[model samples]
Target: MKWSEICIHTTEEAIEPVTNILYEAGAGGVVIEDSQDLQQTFLSDEGSEYSLDPADYPIDGVNVKAYLPVNSFLGETVEEIKQSVNSLLLYDIDLGDGRLTFSEHNEEEWATAWKKYYKPVSVGEHFYIVPTWENFDPEDPNRKVIELDPGMAFGTGTHPTTVLCIEALETHMSKKAEVLDVGTGTGVLAIAAAKLGARKVHAVDLDQVAVQSAKINVKLNKVQDVVTVSRNNLSDNVKGQYAIVVANLLAELVIRLAEGGVADLLQKDGLLIASGIIRPKKEQVKEALIKSGLHVIEEMDSGDWIALVAEKAE
Candidate 1:
């Protein structure tokens, strides 16, 4: 039940790289701590700015906070952990939550606390998300349903980015279309596509845990036959063109993939739905998609989150 926190102090420039390394090293979750989070942790409640001199913080740029359950097989020996931690010479490591001046807490205990925040959420008229421990009376047997226990994958149907992608899929998917969900965080989008009548759905992610979690959610939805999960990027190993391609990833990655000829994997008239785009970077992604021979077909927004649906030029 104990949760071990690994705090990596690195310049803002290296935080992402360090995050990637630590993630590969077996951390369950990697949180990039921005100045805002730091301010909130130390200054927010005081109704005043942080009084500490900026130099006191490893505030050269940013910090990475990773969380792992103590009972999980993240790593055993301090030597083993240090060897991985030491790989980042430019960064410092704190084995506990150094940011919060408080006692450590158990995650298994926190897991129960987190459940109180979860409630049945509806994505659209035809679909409803039911937590594994909750029950729902189906108003219609044909209504699409997805049961999920979001252990640790990114998409939980809560974030604006996720909902925007779902809305984009709903706008374009047809009963006979094949769907390819890139970066399928909890397989939520792919499952929704299948229930929305996608003939076949292929879901992929670079994280093994995400892949496994997607599989679990797909099984829970009883859509295993239509949803195929894999741990791979869309680079070269992926095959065939899909009628609908969904990539709910960071804006930069989405832009790169769109321009990097990944659109060639889409059918001539296929739809490409991309989300996880911050407000500021939207224009860059739109330009990239245009340069990649796609025309913007639709745009959906939820709060500051945005989703773009483009079609490969016929």
Candidate 2:
């Protein structure tokens, strides 16, 4: 079988969001060729055999490549992916040159190539993010493991934004609490909530692919009984008040959701965990939450990303 390899030239700051765009467009795996990777110290020979051609990498930015099957809808899919990546600008994310290119390759060439980049990662204190292909045994018996294969969904539970959300959840999640995870890509936050003893979790994503992916991950984590994955835009279709509402979305989207009344979806004094926000937009998102009748209680930062924890006004 033939595959279309889509390569996006973007900055490191845009990597997570751009890769997420490809994932949402049904790219099964992604390979990142960052110029910085060449300078990093190697701990093992795992990636030594993989040829790193300087010609294939950008001198000033990173190149993210994803494989999509060559099919009738390939053109439309690629266009949609480009549009989604471009939309990152609304969140003030830098895309560098924003050059996108593609080539045709054999399916066998990329089938296992992306796996080298994924490894077991510890998210919060008690949660470990383990890829499906990795065999990991936690040294701490009290640690909970979330086994995941991202497939075409976004959240890998490794990005700093996701790590902030998971850590926030760990601190605010109450036993038997009813949680709502908006934009629940791969259902990572929802699964975490369930594992943390939430009585019920409503995981919703606007992307159908994400909804399906979340369902699979929820079941894989053995939390299907506690988590319900569905397709919904923001909190549009979500009913009832939640003890906690978590959204790992762009700063712009978070503001829109906040203005559209995210506080209405939360119970009084309930917590809201908003992530996927860049440092520059941190105050903007906080103001939006405050205007929506929520008060910022805590702020967490990792690199250039920030996550805000808020509580509904009494």
Best by TM-score: 2
Q: Write the per-residue lDDT of candidate 2 for residues 145-195, one digit (tens) a residue.
A: 899988777657776778889999889888999999999988989999999
Compared with the true structure, what per-residue lDDT tens digits does model 1 show for residues 99-126? 3211245766544644443445556556
> Any idea how many clashes model 1 has?
2
lDDT of the candidates, in the order given:
0.69, 0.84
List candidate 2 segments past 4 Å from native: 12-29, 32-62, 69-93, 101-104
Q: Give candidate 2's whole-model lDDT.
A: 0.84
Q: Tell me each candidate's TM-score.
A: 0.72, 0.84
Candidate 1 overall lDDT versus native: 0.69
Model 1, which residues run further than 4 Å from truth? 4-103, 138-143
Clashing pairs in 1: 12-61, 12-62
Worst 10 residues of 1 by lDDT: 40-49
